[model samples]
Every structure is written in structure tokens, then in C-alpha cells.
Target: MSTPALQHIAAVGAGRMGRGIAIAFAYAGHEVALIDIKPRALEATAKLETESLAEIGSSLRMLADLGMFDAGELPAIMARVRFVGLADAPAALEGADVVFEGVPEVLDGKRDAFAFICEHVRADAIVASTTSTFLVTDLAAFVTHPERLLNAHWLNPAYIVPLVELSPHPGTSAEVVDAMKAMLERAGKVPVVCAAAPGFIVPRLQALIMNEAARMIEQGIATAEEIDKATRYGFGFRFASIGVVEFIDFGGNDILYYASRYLAQAIDPTRFAPPAIVEQYMEEGRIGLKTGKGFYDYTGVDPDAYRRDVLGRSLGMLRHLDLLRAPGAALRPKE
Candidate 1:
């Protein structure tokens, strides 16, 4: 028999990430309450939630048709969700096993949101944050139950992506950590325990590479599209499977040394040197992947074309990597 949905899941701030996360829990058969500050925001969230769920349901049907799932399960999964607002958040979470806070990235906002939640939630409910940067310990300061507040950072579009870094505050109890792990595992996520730090691990690593890529483009060393293409086609595919160190080992240290030394010198390596916001997007003229132009053109191109192109390349790389790593497949245990 399939696992039952998480009885009660509370999600605050039904914006992009919030809506996606709420839908993820709902899709997994949990009843979700999505809270927002404004009524209009709540309305928008509900509409987006419907659209997201429909798209997700269609995808699941495709998988089932391909023999990935038995017949007639997706609808039942969709049926298990509901949404609410801040005033109702506490009531909805009365006996909630887990509460996922996807509030604004700002510190004061999250503190207030959690403070309100702490007043309403049951003592046993494990309050988890989907924060990208704010320190968990700091966020926990607003709540009486710091031990229950942990950072469960899910990659964008949480459903499809499997990596979730579960970083707990210093006060978080072992039981709370384990409960959070079990909750995510039941939802089919690959949860990694990480120490609480700025950007945690994946974000920190990705930002480093992405920052360098941005600097290269800004300095006219390469176009934004060229940098992205090179990264994805050249090392991106390989790194997904083998990881950096393993890829270095496979390529032999000599070639690695040469590339690192040459590339490092060619590009700025001040490390977080270029300001983040300035480098986040390409120059106004260089807005690729949007406005029907970037390094490529999409004036008359079907929007879905981009998705198909990306999916094709990514899936192929993943398939190849899986085959290569099958013999040694296992989770990396935390130190």
C-alpha cells in the first residue's frame, strides 16, 4: 500500500517558492495550508497552485502511461491538499506533524512569520525553514522552540529536483532532525545534512562557479551564452555524475592542473569579488533566454522548444552518468 499523506503541512508565504513547496506536499498526499499577508497574494497563490498541480498531474499520467506508475493514483494524490491564510494557519496546523516555512528571504519577515507560527503550532510539530541564506539559529531566535527550527532548503521546483540540504540550528534536537529526514524521505527527496553556514553547501559551490562565469562574460572574455553552453556541454554533464574530485581523477591530475592554472589566471578569482546582483544577470542587451534573444534567438521559436532542448541534453547526461556510477551507487554519509 502507498504511504499516507503527512496529516497536516503548513506553508507560509504562497509566493513562487511557497506555492511550489505547498503543491509539492499536496502532491505527496498531504493537506497543505498556504498562508500569505495579503488576500490578493493568497488568491494568486491558489490560482498558481491549481495550474501547477494540473501540470504535475499530467506529468504523472505520462509516467504512468510509460509504466512508471499503476493506474489512477495521481488524482487521489491531488485530492489530499487544501489552502488557508495566516489567521487560519495555526488552526490548520493544530495537530500538524510538520510545518514548512517558505516565507520571504528577509530576516525580519521570517522572524515575525515564525513568531506567529510558534504561538499557534503544537509543541511536537517540527518547524522547518526553506531558507536559502539567513542563519537558522538566528531565525530560530524568534521562536520559543529553536530546537524545532531547521533549514530544509529545497532546490527551485522542489518536486522534480531531489537534493534538499537539511541544516539544523545548534539548538535543534536529534529527534527533530530525524523526524525532518523521515518526512522528506517519505516524499522522495534526497536529503543531505549540512552545517548551518552562509549559502550552505550546494548554493555556495554553485555561486562560486556561476560567479566566475558571470565575471568572464562581463569582462568580454566570453558571451553569457557561450559560458553557459561551455559549462553545460563540457563539464556540467560530467560533474553531475562523477563530481569534481572524481572528474579530476578520471581526467588525470596533469590536465586538471593545466586547466585550473590557465583558467584561474584568465578569469578574476578574487572569490565573491564581483558584486552578486550586478553579475546575476547578463547586461541589459545580453538578456538571453528571455525577450526572444540572448546568445540565441527565439523570436518565432516555440517556448516549449527550450524546455525540450534542455531536458534532452540533461536526461541524456544523467542516463550516461547513472550507468557509470551504478557499480558504486550509495548515499554519501555525513561526517
Candidate 2:
């Protein structure tokens, strides 16, 4: 939004991720070329273009109605996103500032897409793969300037998600990382740099939480509705205000150390055991808030003010859920 970070953007696939990326750039006032470079029938290509544009248009209109922008500007933003067939791939990619490849998840599909995209895109262009499966290293192996390639793992509905996990290989240039981050930031995205590890950041934590939720249901700990409410009001609300590590330190690491041990013994020890780092921290006496040290340090901090801030945030969440009420509403005796 600030000075139009990238004027020329391109997405090399006509699928959901590609469409979402196109809509995002188009919304930010950049011209985007959504190119489907795979060989296909004329009818199939036309159908793909139709589907992509329709979805993008609907999304733009919804945002406009939600007061994100003037409804009159919807057509102009949608106009910025154009679809190109394989024959026009060269012109669509020429002089492009950034290219996002959102092909299928298989290695062969990714390799083929990269081999084709690399030949047309500028050597310095910030090329990125939207693959949730392979690491940046795996995909960068197909490019000539591997330093220019990175994994920009966007959450589903890229146009709405604020976080973009940027995973770079060991040899990726530092300059590229900074430039890529700047571009994403200018487009109103929060880019987090990560290693070429599997699942980047969100996916890894989400996977563990999701499977555990399913296990709880199977074990009859709570019903589906109750778990959903708890997550929405408790787990999600808290994490939304503070980072996971911050919560650990806010409540004292000793709490987690003991809770983890109890769960490990009561349930599956393999699943609930705390990491070795937790034990090491205990040994060193870094037992959070009260100790003035933990996963985070509280040294020199006004304890009362810090607690007040955290409470205010929680109260805000409660207000949003419409659960806050007057003290007089607490109870009433039945007749």
C-alpha cells in the first residue's frame, strides 16, 4: 500500500493459491498476470480462466461490501488481475518483479513448473514456491539462481491471511530475503523468516493441536462443541494476545514443567513429556515471572503494570465475545 512495492507481479498457476495471490496483489494496486503454462485444450484453458476470474471477482466484491474499499473500485482492482495461457507465458513473466509458482504438491510437478518458470523470469526476480509440501531447498535445486528462490508459504485464502512464512535455503542471499520481506511488508503482510524445516511455523504447531483435539474427542474428555468453545474463548483468545512463549513465562515455567510431567504420567508419556529445555531451565532457576527470568525475562519490569496489561487484553477478548456483564447479573434465587 505504501508507494506500490511491486508494479508487475505474476502467478504461474491458475489454481486456488494462484488466484488468491493474484487477488492480493491486485487489491494492492499492482497488475497481476495469472498464467496457466501447462499444455491443455483451448476449452480447458478458457474454463480455467473463467473459474479463476469469477472467484477473484467474488472475493473482491465481498471485501468491498465489508467496507475494505469503495465498491466502485472493485471493477478496477479486478481488472488488474488478468489470465494468460501457456502461449503468453513469456510476455506475462517478462520484467516481472515477483513470480509465485503454485503448482501441484508432487516433486515432479514442482520441478517441471520451476524448470519452465526459471527460463522466462529474470535471473534477479524474487521467485517463490507456494508449495506446502516441499522445503525451499528441494524446489530451489531446479533454479539457476537458487539464491533468488525461497518458500513463501501462505496460509489458505492468501488475500486475508496476514502471515507469510518465508523459508530460505542455506545459500539464499541475505539481500533477497530483505527485499522479499520489504515487498511483502509493503503489501500489508507479516513475513516471518524460517529454516527449510517441514511445516514452516504455523503448520507444525497446528498439526499437533488438531490431532490432540481429535484424540480428546475419542477419549471422551469433552464433546466437539465444548472443545470448540474452549479453543475460541480460551486457547485462541489468549494466544491471539500473546506469543506462546510469553504465556509460558507469564504464568511461570514451573507450572508447565509440573503440568507436563503429570499429563505425561497420566496419559501417554511419549506425547505429553516436556522438552529437555524445560528441565534445563528449571535446573538453572529461570522459573518465570516471579523469578525475574524464564522463557522471557521480567527483570526491572513493574509486575503490577504487566499483570494489569494482560488482564486488560483478556477482558477485551471477553467483551468481543459479549461475555462481560455487570456484577448484579451474577445470580438470582429461584422461586
Candidate 3:
């Protein structure tokens, strides 16, 4: 089946997320309808419209100040987004090529919004929920056409953030996913697909890291300031250059396996214990790049060249941070 062009974009529930999404698409030169799904009095609706547009305008101005684009282009970008009231939602939705539901994280609210959206939207139009709390599978049940529904989890400050996690249920159409990915890519966003799992990817990984950081502070291991500085300069900086899984392969999975065992014995066994896959991999001798295979295949790959490439990436990050210094540069003595 041919995927339709997602030219007409609409974001239901004109809250912060909707407004952010509107800015994103409008900045990308798409006309986006920021629709308010809830019924409101004329004055209340007007107030919402004012507040939403003002917030969006402020965000755009901030981005402009940060040199994202020229300040003069703000008006044109702002003009591309139209605020629609509940009365006009049907018309707005009917014309949308893709609809994003940004309603509150209440199950009943989502059910009502999806029911309203599915009624007016075209059968072919893609309906994506900009939800961080609910699963795609759970939301799909509310949609009239399950294949056209999926979850697009955008990070906060949607216009600035590059990543958008796409979670599709079993019944979701592959075409829908591809089309949405293409549209997001065109909008200068990085879209990654994940199964219908809790916390998706970033949140799931970060939860553990964040909790550990808190635990360290609670245990008097490190102050909050120190941990944050370490995270910014070391943990985040390194991970920014290489993915966690890729790092495991680069450093050798055996390192992780052994470290896991040590941590388990030293600290909390249940929390630090290695998964079965790591143990199995160690048993099978499928450790990492050193062994020609691990999380990624390195067959027919030149180890020396790959190592150089990794070093180059790390060097690039250092250069970006202005942390790279000349070989003979002298360090200043503490006064």
C-alpha cells in the first residue's frame, strides 16, 4: 500500500506538548492545526488560544535568540500554526493527513479524545498519540482503525529535541510507521522505532542511571553537584559519542559480565546481577569485538580501523566541547 503524504498535520489538545509539536511542524514549513478537544466557553477558549500562541511565540523567540533561526522568520513560522477550538475540531481533523493526540495522561481523557478523533479523521489518516504514560496497545483499542494508530513519545521541548520514539502495537501497519518516520525525518527529527514496551528506550535506561545517581547521594558516596558534573563531563560525554550497547561491544561484553558480578557481590546482588544473555554469551565465547562477535557482528571487519574510527568519534566530541588541547599545553598551577 502506498503511504500518503503527511502534509496536513493536526495536534489535538493544545497544551504544552501540542504547542511544542505545532512549533516543530510549523518551523519545518508545515501548516499545523493546534486543536483544543475539550468544550469550553467562548471567553475561555479565547483565553486558551491566547496563552497557547503566546507560549509558542515565546519558545520560538528563545530558539531564535539561541541562533536556531533568524528572528524575522518567527512571524512566518507562527502564522503556519492555527489554533482551533472544539467546535472546529471536526473540520480540522477531517482535513488532517496525520493527527497527534496530546491530551492529558488520563485513560478516560485519551479514550474520549481518540473516539472523537477517529470519528472525524479519514480512515487513511495516521493517528499518533504523543503519550509518555500509556502503551500503544492500550491506546489502539480506543481507535476505530488500530492499524493507523501508534504512540509518538516526544521528549520535552519538542521543537529543540531531535529524538521521537515511535512505539507501535502488533496491529499497527508497517506503512503507517514508515510514513510517520519519513515525516518526522523531514521535520529534522530523529525517529527511532521500539516495540510497545514500558518507558520505551531512553526513559527505561535513564531511570536506572538516575536512580543510581540518587542512591549514591543518599549513601554519601557523592554530592549532587559532583554527580551532575561527573555525568556531564564523563558519563554523558562518553555516551554522547557511543551508544551503551555499542560501548559494551567496543569495550568487550566480558568487562560488563565481570563488572556485573563484582557489583552484585559488592553491593546489591538482585540489582547488579547480570542478565542470562550475558552469562550465556560468556559461556559461548561470543564476548565482543576482540572475539569477532558480541552484540554486533565484526566478521570481515578490520579491528584496527574500527578502533581508530571509535577514537575519531571520541576526539570529535572532545573538539566539540573545546576540551582537546595541544600536546605541549601546560596546566595552570592552583594558587
> Which candidate leads in TM-score?
3
Alpha-carbon lDDT of model 3: 0.94
Model 3: per-residue Cα lDDT at residue 10: 98
Lowest summed lDDT over 10 consecutive residues: which window, candidate 3?
Answer: 326-335
| Highest lDDT model number | 3
Q: Write the per-residue lDDT of candidate 2 for residues 1-335, one digit (tens) a residue.
A: 11223569999889899999998888888899999999999999999889889999998889889998999998899889899999989988876888999998889988888898888987778889988999998877898788888899999899999999999898788887888888888889999999999989999999999999999999999999999999998899999877899899898888999999999999989999999999999999999888999988787999889999989988888898898987877685544
> How high is each candidate's TM-score?
0.68, 0.93, 0.97
Compared with the true structure, what per-residue lDDT tens digits does model 1 show for residues 134-157? Answer: 878778778776777788998987
Cα-lDDT of candidate 1: 0.69
Ranking by TM-score: 3, 2, 1
Residue 78 C-alpha lDDT in model 3: 95
Positional deviation of residue 67's Cα in model 3 after best superposition, in angstroms: 0.9
Worst 10 residues of 2 by lDDT: 1-10
Clashing pairs counted in every model: 1, 0, 0
Clashing pairs in 3: none
**Where does model 2 exceed 4 Å of error?**
1-5, 327-335
